[model samples]
Every structure is written in structure tokens, then in C-alpha cells.
Target: MKKNLLIIPSIIFTFVLLTFFYLLVIERNPSELPSNLLNKDIPIFEAENLIKNKKFISTNEFGNEIILVNFFATWCKPCRDEHSYIKQFNNNGIRVIGINYKDDPKKTIQWLEKLGNPYSDIPIDKHGRIAIDWGVYGIPETFLVNSKGIIKFRHVGPMSKKVFKKINLLIKEIK
Candidate 1:
């Protein structure tokens, strides 16, 4: 009976080790973390517009057409790196709402002016409340919301060429 107990525990330990090894070996995108908000309606909130001197209300901005909601900050290097890709999305006729996350308004304006703004609306999230509502994991997160205002896909971190292509394809598929 003593040997049987030891053998059973050993077997279970080995099985768990193998399962972990399999998971580590399998191909997976670490940046593609699952989001609780995926496939759900965007969280309702309103904020002052950074650029247009108007209120950026959640109810008014999302339902009519597909939109990209990008949470970015001036201090984040990755956000700067992905700015070109964000601009490309806008240039391709994708309406983008750039949420300025916990950043200084003056610096954000200067950053956009230097980078060439591509966002249709710039909402100020001074204390990161909007980002919290959206369940943003970090700066430079992007969400693809459908015409009906439901979030379809989310990408975290800097946008790379591969990611940009994947998003373009997703947009096509969504349409």
C-alpha cells in the first residue's frame, strides 16, 4: 500500500510536468492575451476631447461604423514605435479614437503634432479611468470594435508589421 501511494503521486507529477512542457512548446502569441471585454459592448464613459474642444462620449462615437480604440501614452517608447502603424490604419480609412492615457495634455499635443495625428478623436484619460474601464493591460493597447460597438479583437503592446498585416486582414474579414 505504501508503494502504491508513492507510485500514484509520481505518475501525477510526471503528467503535470509533461502537460507544462507541451504548453511551452506549442506556438502561441504572448501578446495576444485573452480579454474579458472581447465580444462585449464597450464600457460606457465620457471624457474631454484633447484636440477638438468637445466631449468624447462613448455612446456617440462607436455604433455607426467600425473603429479602432488605441490607448497610448507619450512616455511609452512602444507607443511611439507603433505610431506609424496607427497612422497607416487611419490613412487606410479606419476611424481611430486615440485615448490619451494618463499623459500630460501639452506633451500629448506636441507628440501628436510631431508624429502627425491620425486619430479622428483624442480623448483624455487623465487618471486612466477610461483604460481601466476598457480593461487595458498596458499602454499601446488597441481594440477593434465593430460597427455595432462590440469589441471584436484586442492587441497588446507595440504594433509590428506582422501585427499590422493581421489587423488589416481582420478588418477585411470583419467587413
Candidate 2:
């Protein structure tokens, strides 16, 4: 009986240690930045437009237009919630492009239909390679790029009117 009691405590201790190690060491902190690419040239990516599915979208498509690149996923609630703000940005003459992160074309289409499409162009990043290139750690991140293709601002979560106003000011400054 004493041996069993000791074994139970040992097992509990081992489990606690393993849990601590997994949480603190093995798992990565989600907020960690792998690189400092902000305020630099927007990374170029080539992806198929989710709407058309025939043509490809690349950095070159932006041309001289200031671009707002939004990284979103169909499953993300915040991405759905931010759709109206994105529409407002688009209506304000800000060019908006969407990078659909690791989502199915059919589901993406359905999500857009439900939320109302706000993007001037929506590209499918089925593998998330483009998101990795842009240093996106989470969905619903946005980057404001200038006409020259330099990233001027990055917002890492659901956008609001206050953030939109700041982006608008940056756009005016860049223009």
C-alpha cells in the first residue's frame, strides 16, 4: 500500500513537470516576431484570386495604388467581424486586397457572401507561405502599403474606426 502511494505521487509529479515543460519550452510564444519587416518593402507574393480563380494576383497588380493587405481566414471570427470596417476602408478609396489563409475556395466564397465582400481583390494563400513571408502570426492582421510598395503600417488584430483613421492619415502622408 505504501509503495502504491509513493508511485501515485511520483506519477503526478512527473505529469506536472511534463506539462510545465510543454507549456514553457516546447511551445512557441504566439507573439514572437521572427523578423523586423515592417516599414520595409511589402513582400511579393503570387496567388490565385479566390473570386475569379482564373487569374493570379501579385505585388505588381497594385501598381501605383496604395494597398491594404489583410490576412484572414474563413474560420476566424474576428475576420468576419471586421468585414464592415474593411468595406468602409474600400469605400474610402483605400485599395484593399485579401489574403485568404489556408481556407477552401468554396468556404471562402461562402464566408465572403455572408460577410459581404470588401476586397477589391482576394487571393488564396492555401499553404500560408505568403502569410509566413509577411510575418503574420495570426489571422485578421493588416498591412498598409504605400504607392511605392513600402509597408507603412501594420495592425495585428481586428481593425476599428480609430485604426482606420490612423491608416488614412498614413495614406495621405505617403501620397
Candidate 3:
């Protein structure tokens, strides 16, 4: 009876060791956080347009297509780091709407000009209220919202090549 009990404990320990090894060997980015608003309707708000000189209304903008909304700022290095990937979406005929989070309009305009403007509509979130509504805690956050204005996927940090490919795949699946 004691031998059987010892065998059972040994088996359990071996299983736990294998589980830890499996987890350690898996490919995953630790920095990415899942969005709280997945499959939920986008947060509604009206903000000034940085370029259009008009009220940028959420209801008026969304619900027509599979759009990628980027919450970014000129000051954030990650935002700058991810600019090319963001532009790639535009290059592939995706409409990217940018929410300029708590950034100066002049700096934003200049930055876009230098980086090559990829955004279709640039809305000024002079205060980060829009970001808060979208559950954004960091700059360079990207959200993919479907035609019905439901947020499908969100990436929290700088866009990597791997991440870009993943987003493209997700976009196709949702569409």
C-alpha cells in the first residue's frame, strides 16, 4: 500500500515537471495584454479632427468597414517604432483611423508628414478620454473593429512583423 502511494506522488511530480517544461518552451510574447472590450461595441465619443477641422464623431465614422483604430502619439517611441507596420495596413488598402492621444497637433502633423501619412482620418484626442474609453493604457495600442463597430482584436505594444502578419490573418478571418 505504501509503495502504491509513493508511485502516485512520483507520477504527479513528473506531470508537473513536464507541464512547466512545456510552458517554458512555448512561443509567446509576455508584454501583450488582452483587451477588455473584445467583441464589445466600441466606446462612443466626439472629438475634434486634427486635420479635417470638424467634429470627429464615433457613430459617423465606424460601422461601414473593417477598420483599424490606432491610439498613438508623437512622443511615444513605440508608436514611432510601429509606424511602418501601421503604414503597411494602409498600403494593403486598409483604412486606418488614428486617435492622436494627448499629443500636440503641430507635432503630430509634422510627424505624419515625415513618416508618410497612412491614416485616413486623424482625430485629435487632446485629452486621453478617447483612449480611456477604448481601454488603452499605453501609446501605440491598435484595435481592429469590424463593420458593425465591434472591437475584434487589440494589440497593446509596438507592432512587430510577426504581430503584423497575425493581424492581417485576423482581418481576413473576420471579414
Measured against the true structure, the TM-scores of the candidates, in listed sequence, are: 0.88, 0.76, 0.91
Error of 3 at 127 (Å): 2.5
lDDT of all predictions, in order shown? 0.93, 0.83, 0.91
Best by TM-score: 3
**Per-residue CA lDDT of candidate 3, range 1-175, in tens?**
9999999989999999999889789986666678889999999999888888688899998999999999989999999999999999999999999999999899999999899889988888887888998989878899999999999999888999998999999999989
- Each candidate: RMSD to true structure? 2.5, 9.5, 1.6
**lDDT tens string, model 1, 1-175?**
9999899989999999999999899977755679999999999999999999789899998899999999999999999999999999999999999999999999999999999999999999999989999998788999999999999999899999998998899899988
Question: Can you give the lDDT of residue 172 in candidate 2?
Answer: 85
* Count of backbone clashes, every candidate in sequence: 0, 0, 0
Better of 1 and 3 by lDDT: 1
Residues 1-175 of candidate 2 have per-residue lDDT tens digits of 9999999989999999999888888755466454467768877777888877566547567658898989989889898788888988888878899989999889888888887888878888889899989988888899888777878788888887888788888888888
| CA deviation > 4 Å runs, candidate 3 | none
- How far does residue 39 in candidate 1 sit from its true spot (Å)? 0.4
Native RMSD of candidate 2 (Å): 9.5
Task: Flag regions of model 2 displaced more than 4 Å.
Answer: 1-35
